[model samples]
Target: MTLDVALSHRFKDFALDVAFEAPAGVTVLFGRSGSGKTTVANALAGLLRPQSGRASINGTVLFDTAAGVWLPPHLRRVGYVFQEGRLFPHLTVRRNLLYGRWFARGAADGASFERVVRLLGLEHLLARRPGALSGGEKQRVALGRALLSRPQLLLMDEPLAALDEARKAEILPYLERIRDQTEVPILYVSHSVAEVARLATTVVALDRGRVVRAGPAAAVLSDPEAVPTLGVREAGAMLVGRVVRHHPDGLTEVALSAGPIFMPRLEVEPGVSLRIRIEAKDVIVARGRPEGLSALNILPAEVATVRRGAGGGVIVQFRAGQDLLLARVTRRSADALELIPGAACHLVMKSVAVAQADIGEVAQAD
Candidate 1:
């Protein structure tokens, strides 16, 4: 399913005008606070009606101002997962999930309650109430509830924003499972670059009520031109690889298209595909493959683009085998090394620089 959205709305203090196409898989609406991310999600879910706009899922128009069509929230087959679980305080987990299933009474592809519970690992908590679950567990039940509605699209508005790091970590894998296992397309709103890197198949970057960038996650994340909009500190590149083996020294070897790279141990088994995020700030560019370095991962690459930032830093994009990676270097360092398009260099990354949170299992191929 493809989500096409074009909206224009006027508020007392802000005017929102944005348009983007979200293809199948998780399409993340990313930006800083007050960038209209939630506004877009609300528009899609029929919670807000823009002054003039059109929204459609695979040609099924939910709203078209020009045509005078507007589907109410209950009539739109779009499941919404808010930042809070918003589960019933008096109901058991089973009942709360069933409430969503009730809306799918006549749907042809309503999700099975048992399958939803298993998919979210909610079997153990089914008999418990919302008060008995942790933040992550509550979110899982919320997700299961959303899935059970059998919506054609899912709208998630910073579902992880309210959680601390530990809770966020706990729920990320389940979100990945939903992205991989379900056919429903998702419009996820988030300000977190890490979440975008780990879960987004496509990214639509918004800035102050407008779309600044939109494309595949890899292309958008690695684009040097997008560094300013994505926040220089949060800019990064993603690499997809398969687990090769685990070493006794407490490291896991993953084979990237560029070559083999080692990182802190991962719990996943050998041959499992993984997506790794390498932040531009965490990378060091060397003109030559340096020896005697503390870093364990180094890949040969050719400079693809170099753009100077407002400050003294320069964002450099380089191609390593089939993948592109990003590096943020000082202007002085870039000039010293003569970094330019086609210039050869090596990306030096410390094995420990890759945080456990930045590594995620890639969606299984269909």
Candidate 2:
């Protein structure tokens, strides 16, 4: 399913005018606070009617101001997951999930319930109440409930925003499962670059009520021109690698298109595909392959693009094998190294540079 949205709304001081098309899979609406991310989600969910706009899923128009069509919130098959789980405090997990069936309009079947429970790993928590669940567990329950609703689209508005790091870590895998396993398209709103890197198949980056960038996750994240919008500290590239083997010295080896890269040991077995985020600031560029460097990962690359930042740094993109990697270097260094598109170079990165939190399992099709 593809989500097409064109919305215009005016608040007392803020005017939101944005439009974008999101393809199937997890399409993340990313930006800083007050960028109209939630506003778009609300518009699509029928929670808020924009002064003038149009929204549709695969040509099924939910609202079209020009045509005088407006579907009420209940009529729009959108399942919304908020920042908090917002599950009923008194209801058992089973009941909370079943509550969604009430809105399914008899479209959901017994197999749907079983599928959702298993997809979210909720079987063990069925009889427990929300009061007894951890924050991650609660969110998983909430996701199961949403899935059980049998919505055509899912809107997640910073579903991990309320959780601490530990809880966020715990729920991320389950989100990955939903993205890969279900046919439901998702419009996820988040300010987190880590979440975008890990989960997004397509990224629509908004800035102050307008779309600044929109494309596949890899292209958008690897673009140096998006640095200012993505936040300098958060800008990075996503690399997909397959686990080759675990070494005896407590390191895991993964095969990237650029060749073999080593990182801190991962718990997954060999041959499992993983998505790894490589922060631009953590990379170093060399004119040639250095022989004495301690970095475990060094790949031959060619400069893809070079963009100078407002400050003293330059964001350089490199085509490392089939993937693009980024590096932030000083303006002087970039000039001294003659970093330009098509220029030959090498990317140097240490094994420990990849954080455990930045590593995620690649969603697989069943």
Quantify all predictions' global Cα lDDT against the true fold. Answer: 0.92, 0.91
* Candidate 2 lDDT, 225-294, residue by residue in tens: 8888999998899999999999999999999998999998999999999999999999999998989888
> In model 2, which residue pairs have backbone atoms overlapping below 3 Å?
none
The candidate maximizing lDDT is 1
**Candidate 2, run of 10 with poorest lDDT:** 102-111
Q: lDDT by residue for model 1 over 114-178, one digit each (tens)?
A: 98898899988989999999999999999999999999998899999999999999999999989
Model 1 Cα shift for residue 76 (angstroms): 0.6
Return the TM-score for candidate 1, rounded to 2 decimals: 0.98
Q: Write down the TM-score of every candidate.
A: 0.98, 0.97
